[model samples]
Target: MTASYVAIVLLGAFAGGFVNGLAGFGTGLVALGIWLHVIDPLYGAPLVAICSVAGQLQTLPAIWHAVNIRRLLPMLVGGVLGIPVGILLLGHMAPDLFRLSLGLFLIAFAIFMMFNRSLPAMRWGSKKTEGMVGFCGGILGGLAGLSGPLPTIWVTLKRWEKDERRSVFQMFNLTILACVAISHLAIDGITVAFSQLVLIALPGTFVGAFAGIRLYRRLNDHRYNLLVLIMLAISGITLVVSEIG
Candidate 1:
């Protein structure tokens, strides 16, 4: 890769890791777009998968105590089950249309969350519900390397506490991303460029993750909710532009 490309990858990694650390998700949403400028999505998607796992691992120490194993199990199972289906559909599906539709939906949903004060919490946010959401997340993850949105939106609507949200976000993302990375690697043996990019991105991931954890620690419930909504809006716009551009 050229020097400029290396710089772009590193910059994207830091920014993506920062967002992931802060919100427990969204590294690909922020970073893949940047990396796509330097590399093709075929390679970029796997790079995102590996780098995102690294970023999530960085924040694990801080959020480990908050993880709810019971709540996470169903999602993990559902996500795993959905992956093959998503992969099967990837080449045949019209991703641009799917992404545009998803982006608009996220944008509209985030707006509602931002303005509405009386929105009711999902009292029935049970394991079944989480599993359905996770299945959708896995499908998206397999199809486009974007899995964080559905779970993030679900937890946000459920009005989960900061810790609970982080726990779910971090663990859930780590699982799906790892699965995607492995699947990609199994199909396409790791290239020299991919290995180099992963190495180049590691430092940024660690640094940004450290900073993000600190910021996350200081946020109250209200601030956390606001942050998630803002991120959802930004991610939605990013997806739309990526599809259309």
Candidate 2:
């Protein structure tokens, strides 16, 4: 790619990564719009996914204690079941439907979480429910290469403490990214085009992650969620606009 394209992708990665690090889900939403201006949308999915996988790896260490097996285990269990179906369905999905579906989900979920802000406060699920959440997450992950929102919504529904809620979210998404990275690689095959962009995205992701972590320390998560919700709405609107145009 040309140096100008590389610069744009990296700038998106920087902002996407930081927002994700601090807020937990908007990295792809933020980056996708920016990157779409530079690259074909097909390549855009995997390209953004790769950058996110890299940044989440960096965050795994920083939030070491935040790892809760209760949350992770259930989601992972559900994810394994959900991924294959999602992959199969994705192969048949029209690009427009996929884009619109994801956009709508983000918009609705963001709005609900912003106003609702309520969840169960206990480990209140059977193995069946946990697996169901993971199944939903995995399907979304396989489809879009990003689907941590379902599981995050699940935890939010449970009313966990704010720190626990955020921790579970980061770790769960990190896991979803890991799963999506593998699926994307297997399904799409690695391309030099993505590799070249990923090289540039790496540094930008780092820059964003550092900024996000700094902000994480300062803001309580209610504020954090509100900020991210607004971003999600903006990102979703842009995607729809892009499609319409």
Error of 2 at 32 (Å): 1.7
Which portions of model 2 miss their true places by more than 4 Å? 91-106, 117-123, 231-245
* Best-fitting candidate, scored by TM-score: 1
Against the unseen true structure, what C-alpha lDDT does each candidate score? 0.85, 0.73
For residues 1-245, write the lDDT of model 1, one tens digit per residue.
Answer: 68898899888999889988898888877887788888777777788788889989888988788887887999988888878878889889898899899899989999998899478897876779789888988888888777888888888878978888878867888999999889889999988877888899888888888888899999999999999999889888987987888
Poorest 10 consecutive residues by lDDT, candidate 1: 117-126
User: Can you give the lDDT of residue 233 in candidate 1?
Assistant: 90
> Which pairs in model 1 have colliding backbones?
none
Candidate 1 wrong stretches, greater than 4 Å: none
